[model samples]
Target chain A: MATRSRALLPISFVVLLFLLLYLGLYLNPRHESDDSPMIGKLAPEFDLPDLIATGDRFSRADLNGQVSLVNVWATWCPSCRAEHDVLMRLAATGEVPIFSINWTDRPDSGGSREAALLWLGRLGNPYQKTGDDGENIAGLEWAVTGAPETFLIDVEGRICNRITGPLNDRPVPNPENRQEVRNNVGNIMKTVRKMVAGEGKCLTQDS
Target chain B: MPYSRFMNGLIELNKGLRMMQKQLIKMVYLLLLLWAPLSAAAPIDSLIFETQLQEDRFKQLVQEIRCVKCQNTNIAGSNADLARDHRMKVYEMMKQGKSDDEIRHWFVVRYGDFVLYRPQIEARTWLLWGLPLLLIPVGAWLLLVQLRRQRVQATEEAPVVGALSESEQKKLDEVLK
Candidate 1:
């Protein structure tokens, strides 16, 4: 029995090593461990003029008293364009209030307030309120690598989650690959519902 | 006579091979010289700093910070717009008299610990920082085990030094009988 256990030791170790590597495959670079550290922290403060209404200001305090979504969008970002419909679908549900930051709306980035106005005019605006960020003053604070990142903020103005890529609800055709797939909108809705039930503080993800 | 000629032919063939190998090595070295600039120097030459101290700090900070967009590259080496923006931010902060720690902490707040090139020795990074120290003891233990095995093998190979002679064996047998 001692010899048998001794033989099984290395075998069990190899099995564990293989299992770790297999689990590592699912732990992609954008895995939960790589999730933004801004989670569970107060939303970064920024006071900007409204994207549509000229006189109105939108700031961190505006996000208080309710759970809401803050999406970063720009005309130059095609992914933002692609996910506009998802945001529209999500907005129609009235599950949560959706706000936006018109990130990098400057001439150099091929985006301007007029272009944004035209795009929203054509595409139908889903944002409840849009903050103009021509100089990307807020983007730097929010750690925005690029446009089209969405944030979920709780009632107290703490960030609950941050979605890095375009939100999608498309079905994964292969069931076996489901573990790697992100049902972004569905998951966001689930989190939103849980938050509405008063549990929106960012839960520690066990990655 | 023919065997010597064959030997001479083989010698000439070897000389030719050696010459070709030398030429190939020279070509590779020349190609590598040309390839060096593209990887080492990116498009960050346009940035202007006020003083040498500020410039030095900017350069150091850029290398010490990771480019979120590129993930693998330090911000100094990445040509991505975000990296460029980060470089500008670092320069701006330095001009405003922000300390290095403050600038680094600012980035940490925005981008998290991943932004740092050298992560802090915290609970999450204890394994990463302590790995080299951990390897020292492990290596010492492995060497000890290896030395012990070698010593065992050495002792087994050496013949018994004081074996009984044939006369002694016979005397012992007679005594026993």
Candidate 2:
């Protein structure tokens, strides 16, 4: 009986190890949502040229004293294109000012400063002002990994939330998925309203 | 005489072959040495730091931070535009006299612990760092217990040499007679 029990002990230990390993398989090592630690912190400051009006400059000071969405985008990013219509719709609502940073619009990377202006011209210019971050100096400060990341800044210029992916209601391109599309935009709007009301520190999707 | 001459020719040929092989190896080694530094050196960006120390720190910092776009690669090693931007950010911060901790903190604030190659040892990471230490002793103890048990079992199963069975003794006596 003792030998039988002893033999079973190692097997049980192995089973436990496998169980833990199986659990680990479900644990995502990479952070999902709420990964941007920039939430609740002061937004990084930048001064950049306006994408449309090259003579004019867009700076961090412009975001002060207003609840705004600073969207990091570029002509090269397809996700940015995907979110442009949503941004236009949001702008039509006139709920909040949408500032844009044209991130990494260098010609070599299939991005041109002129192309950004052309996009805005064609897309109806949803942004109050578009900053041309040609050299990505401002983009780096904001820790922008890619285009179509939106940062919600409160009246006090503090970043309240960061949306990493495209700001579409439906992540999928299918127009038929109307239900999924409604929830995402509504959620963003609700969060923005909450931030404006000074109800939350950082109202992110996961949080 | 012709045989001896043939032997001498063969020996000369062997000597020539050995010399050529040595020279080839030497040339290969020299080429490898020349290529080594080029591969080791990361591409330097246009942004320059004030001092060599600052530049070195910038390089080290970029390598420490993970590129969000290229999830598997460090910003310094990635050629993605975002990685380039991150590298520039690190350089800019270093030039501004930011400490290593401060720069790392800046990235952590923006990108969470995932941005760091070496995550901070905190409450959340206790298991990640402590598992090996905990498992090693447990494994050793289990091995020791199993070995001791096996030793005891072996002793029990072995025949008692001095206290032989009566039938075995009778057989031995008959054989001796």
True contacts kept of each: 0.80, 0.95
Where model 2 places Cα greater than 4 Å from the true spot, the runs are A14-34, A53-56, A169-183, A194-207, B1-62, B92-100, B154-177
Error of 2 at A153 (Å): 2.4
For candidate 1, give the lDDT of residue B113: 89
| Candidate 1 per-residue C-alpha lDDT over A1-207 given as tens digits, one digit per residue, 9 for 90 to 100 | 978987897899899999999888865555464578888889988999998998999898899888899999999999999999989988898888999999987887888999999999999999999999988888898888887788888888998777777888764423454422443677667777877886555545551
- Per-model lDDT: 0.85, 0.81
Error (Å) of candidate 2 at residue B100 is 4.1
For each candidate, what's the DockQ?
0.56, 0.57
lDDT of 2 by residue, A103-167 (tens): 88788789897888889888898999989888988877787877778888887788876777687
Report the TM-score for the A-chain of model 2: 0.81
| Model 1 Cα lDDT, one tens digit per residue, B114-174 | 8999886789889998999999998899899979989999898996779789999999999
Error of 1 at A55 (Å): 2.4
